[model samples]
Target chain A: MTFSTDIHVDKVRALLQAMEAGDERCTVEILDDITQIRKSELHQQLSELTKNLHQTLDDLDVDTPVLLHAKHDLPDITERLQYVLNETQKASDKTLGSSENTLGLLEEVGTMLEGSDEVSKIQPLLDQASQELTNIMLAQSFQDLTGQVLNRVILIVTELEESLKALIERSRHDYDAIPQKTQSEAEQSAEHEKGVGPNVTAKSKLDAVESQADVDDLLSDLGI
Target chain B: MQINRDMNILVVDDFSTMRRIVKNLLKELGFSKFDEADDGATAWPMVQSGKYDFIVSDWNMPQMTGIDLLRHVRADEKLKDTPFLLITAEAKRSQILEAAQAGVDGYIVKPFTAATLNEKIQKIFERVAEKQNK
Candidate 1:
């Protein structure tokens, strides 16, 4: 194939130079012959390309069973992840709820003691308990943080399922003619989805403005 | 600048636990008259009824986010000047700016102490008081 293409290419170059050098009569005749030769070569290359594509597709078909099995397990993975999120949320709520109730009782006890003349005896201990309960309640805000992080993972997994399905479907199509998306296109879509969800890592480079004061300062700098 | 303990306040969050936590903290701060909504969509009509004296909302909700509620409230002539506070885990600079531009009275990041909530609410009231005095 390469030898024939090289011969055709040398012949075409010689013909073009002849046409450029004022040889007009035979140039059209030989140019038409060269066109036919180029067309036949293109047809041969196309057949080879098609054969290679079929071969790749056959290889993908061999792996289709594994892909299908993986796809089948994705939903179960999603469900288990959801279960973790829900259970953790429930535990967090129960712990925080009970702590709040205890804090409420402690507050009442402290108030009653404050109203009494015997304020010095157990007031410190009650105050300490109140502070500790408040800390426990604050700590349970971990549920919201964890939930947000889990939701981001769920988003990624959901997108992965779609990609996997698309890959499985690609095996059924003559996909060589279709233009695949570039890496930058995928990156742009990912960027659009990024930075909005919970900062799972407190040290995330995307948004390190951890405290409310920093939020205020940033907004203030933006002149909001 | 003092918060009126008896004034009606609406607490909006998608999570029931968050609403409960905010309400508990509010109770600790002596604000008892409370209405709870699961999301901003539910809170909008309640705010429009002119019953809520203050609004403390979580930002990342399902139906309508806290920013959307803030926009709706700010757009309404009846509720434009309502003291709106955002209690959210969204710590991004862009989100904070969006809420501020939507006329949020204050912003409190999540994992916050009851004391922080109290301080932010107090600061909002103080600013409102100063504006009215002006």
Candidate 2:
């Protein structure tokens, strides 16, 4: 069944108009209808692209598992994306207050340094303030480290999506593997819901235990 | 037991930072015969070519991840005997069991120290040595 973009466009326009009108309640039914329609169309487009890839590349002998891997990587990536989002929220909450305080310290140090009359009296105090600011910056802002790592991850994930398209173009093969990736991602989320936050980096409130023997076994397993 | 110094090693992970860290650690472990693959899909062909003796792989990679690669290696007759170790952030019970079931030589969770890496590699070799002797 073909979905006319025009209808979807009109509904979206209507939805935006409702929002612009300061309508507090955008009915759930209306939202669901728009989402379902949009998703179906998106999936259809995806299917078409897959078919195009198959017709173009799979006929050739080039191995496209890399491409297929990228395709299948989406679900896990989406999960990871959500995780990054959550972590970013947590990180922001933890650090943003301290970060602003550190910046305020910067202004204070600058203001004191610029004062000519009390230079000798304030010099040592200013020096201590500067040092404290640096310490706070280091403690509060992982901008240079985790920020860089997370940024790189985001870029690579985006590249994987683009590369999947290119690999399909290069191989002309539709990767049947994409769905498997999604299925695996679904399994992971389900498992995590059952009490294992496998990919979680932050210390959790959950009653999960890390055993010393398990760590020992892990060491042994590492072939050390 | 091929004591081939020429035997290549493939380090598989989507993260270049991780790949570098693992490769450096492996280098320190006296294994310079090495190569890098971004993920399992990329590493498989190298393994299939019978050119690699060792695989130090990250479990959570884009395609053909460490676990998947180890499984593939275990399932394939020619590659089955090759020593495969998993380096990952994933240290869940079922995941570890799954890797063990797939015949992984070792599993190293992330934020691992160099000492930890060395210990794991030594244990793997000792196990392999015992098996060969038997």
DockQ winner: 1
Q: What is the clash count for each candidate, in the order shown? A: 0, 20
Clashes in model 1: which pairs?
none
Candidate whose TM-score is highest: 1
Q: Put down candidate 1 lDDT per residue, A105-183, tens digits, no spaces.
A: 9878877786677888789888888888889888988888889999998888888888766764666743333332233
How far in Å is the alpha carbon of A6 misplaced in model 2?
27
Q: Candidate 2 lDDT, tens digit per residue, B1-134?
A: 33444558888888898888888887776778888888789888888999887888887765556777787888898889999887776667666666776788787766577987877777777777888899
Cα lDDT tens digits, model 1, B13-113, are: 98898899999999999989999999888999889999988999988777888888999999999889999998887777666766777788888887788
| DockQ of each model vs. true complex | 0.24, 0.08
Tell me the TM-score of candidate 1's A chain.
Answer: 0.50
Q: Report the lDDT of model 1 for residue A107.
A: 77
Candidate 2: DockQ?
0.08
lDDT of each: 0.76, 0.68
Query: What DockQ would you assign to candidate 1?
Result: 0.24
